[model samples]
Target: MVITVPATVPIESFQRLRIETYTDVAAAALLVYDYLLTFNVEKSLIWPSRWNIMKVLFLLTRYLPFVDVTLVLFYQLKTNISVETCRATYFPAGWFIVLGIMVAEIILTIRTWAIWGRSKRIGIILGVSALVAIIPTLYIEKVFLDSLVFSPYPSPATPGCLLTAGNPIIAASFVIVILFETLVLTLTLIKGVQHYRIASGRGFVSVLYRDGVVFYIYLFGISVVNLIVIVAAPRDLANLLAIFQRVMHSLLSARVLMNLREANQREYALAGMQSSPLQHLSFSQSRSSEEDRLSFRRNLDGTVIDIS
Candidate 1:
């Protein structure tokens, strides 16, 4: 069955679907991150000290949920809701929703880095950058909108609705942000690798650090590496708009699952030690030492009798 959006949508059309959906995703990401922090996922992999990193991610992503949701609402309003942009005939135009998804992707990427690499400093930096960058985007987008003649959704395709500067300044700002993110991701990879080497040095100590870093490095190698290409991503290149968010969602979920499994495995190991091997060792050593004491006591008694 084919779905179709209406040709004439109310002003709040963008706010309805895109913003609401993006909010759902971003809010969920923030919630999962909080749950992980509350559960001490970082402490499981690194130390309790690392919980601060996850805490920062949770807070920052919580802020970003609004960014995505607001933009999604903006897009639905801006969108014609015609067959051109909305994926279906009567529903949302996916192409134009790229703007909202891009915001979402960047936010999600921040959480992903914090989770995998234990990155607090980077999260703080990115959060600040995003705040500053939004000022310019808002000013630029608004001024550009003012010069337009027709209200959006005046007709099918909405192609002639208005003329807006696909502002290069706004585009350049995102590129700079992406470049900053790339740098942060690179630093995380280096740290994770260093931690991995340290963990390997500990003789029989199970994969506390080694596995943590391995997962981080794997995420970087697989997803972060691809993101480097997007640092120079073009403004009108609408196709790449959704690329970052969709990719981060997949990678973030994967790492979270792996970290959860490792934590459970560690708990099982600790539990097994408490129940079996540790108990046996304590019992055997106690029995052996008691027997030796009894023998020595008998020997002392014999010596005293001989002296008598």
Candidate 2:
């Protein structure tokens, strides 16, 4: 097979690539530093819990890409490497990025499941939706891999994967993720609001409302920004935005999970402390002629239903 070598990029494109490399390195360093600082607090608690496991995976997914990309950059900096080898690196790097995003999305789906009071139906629906979304994503990944070609004359500084040959499919892939996330976030909000009516004063419910909204806003805003940047910005600049998007996904997803766990722990502790000879509020669903009704059952022991 004849090798199709990519042409050297323009000076401006080379500069953009340099900036992307530097920024990615800085972001990765910051993520590592933050993870280490909190290691003592989270180390024992992370692996055993299912939620924590997903969070850990999300973090790894983010970190691994940085390592892979850094190595590719360094390899490009060296001389005498075959174009094929350098071009080959993009496949795995891209896969890492796609896998990380999928993991993050799964975490969000789980969070939505819990927010919906562990409804099996909601979980199933979201699961199916996620599977459908992955089909198109995998197609996009293939397109990206097939498009990978290194510049024929490698620049001294930037000699990695060049802009993918024109492909609208790659540009539109972000929308699939954005729509899926928006659906998850909307479901979460709906469930939260419904539960909030009855569980408004409860600590766990309040935590959900506070943290869940913030999480959705952060991810949603960035996804929109990423989509726009990919479509509108020059390819080199678009690449930077894409990397930064993954960084934010790692940071925010992990942050929200950690905060929720901490809040749950605190609520559990406070409930234990405040146990008194008060009546426990037990909720019951009643069917009436017009609609369903909610009734509370009182218990002799002073424990309220521990929502946390």
Candidate 3:
């Protein structure tokens, strides 16, 4: 028995598609990059410092692949390419995103360990989940390779990669992940709200309020809609879903970047490092003795600070 595969898109068609996809990736990646660039390390009200840095790295690794996958999917839709073609091309591109998620899981798992402190029960719950839930799910995606197109009409036009877990596995996996994400997000929201209530001073609540609730609500909504679209109107909503997924991906990532920056800022503030010259004047008032003051006129790298 012989299996047929996607023919390469016509060079002209592929080039045009490539450019279009490239343009899309460029726009998408830039949104993430700009968010990173503009992100001030003083925004995320509930940052885990080391974890946030890992998140920054995770974002850098993950988002590009997402952009690449977006571009590949765009080409597939535009050129009427095969799903196999989409799978083959997107597989490599998606690796980075998967890698990022893996890293995030690791980083977050550790944080959960810390947050789940003194509770061997929840820690073990998360540990078992990391092994049981995330690992096997990743392995299952491998089935996409060597998978066939299950479409009834055997035509090259309706090209796409078909895998074994179409209805059953796909449905199950999506449900589990969505459910898990909902629970985790809920847990995070509860913790964040409590922290906000206990917080003192002005501007504290505002930071959490900024992206905290809005962003999670957005993510949770996206996950639900994504599952709904995948199950109910997979083909009908391709164009719209692609755009929505891309935007949602950007929003989720941008929040992580912003949160990382905010976490760092809080550490500085807590450490008494984020001080003003006026505050320094108050310190110098009582202890006006010899060698009591130090000059901060140096504009060198470490000497310079941005209070803004």
Stretch of 10 with least lDDT, candidate 3: 292-301
Measured on C-alpha atoms, candidate 2 has an lDDT of 0.61
lDDT per model, in order? 0.39, 0.61, 0.44
- lDDT, candidate 1, equals 0.39
Q: Write the per-residue lDDT of candidate 1 for residues 1-308, one digit (tens) a residue.
A: 11123445555553443443454456446545654554554345423222343334333433343344333334344435432332221122222233342343353444334333334675676567666655665564444333222233556443212221232333443454455445545554564465444333321112323433454454345344334433454222221333334334333433443343454455456546758856655323234333432332243222211100
**Number of the top lDDT candidate:** 2
Q: Give residue 94's error in model 2 in angstroms.
A: 0.3
**lDDT tens readout by residue for model 2, 1-308:** 22232364567877876777776667567667767866654655454454435545545744665665455455435455556666666567677677767776776676666666556798798989998899999998787667655554454443444543545466667898888888888887786677556553444445655666677788889889878877787666666666566666766666555655566577556556557444253321223300211111111001212212
Estimate the TM-score for candidate 3: 0.56
C-alpha positional error of residue 106 in candidate 1 after TM-score superposition, expressed in Å:
11
The stretch of ten residues in a row with the least summed lDDT in candidate 1 is: 299-308
Ranking by TM-score: 2, 3, 1
**Predicted structure with the largest TM-score when compared to the true one:** 2
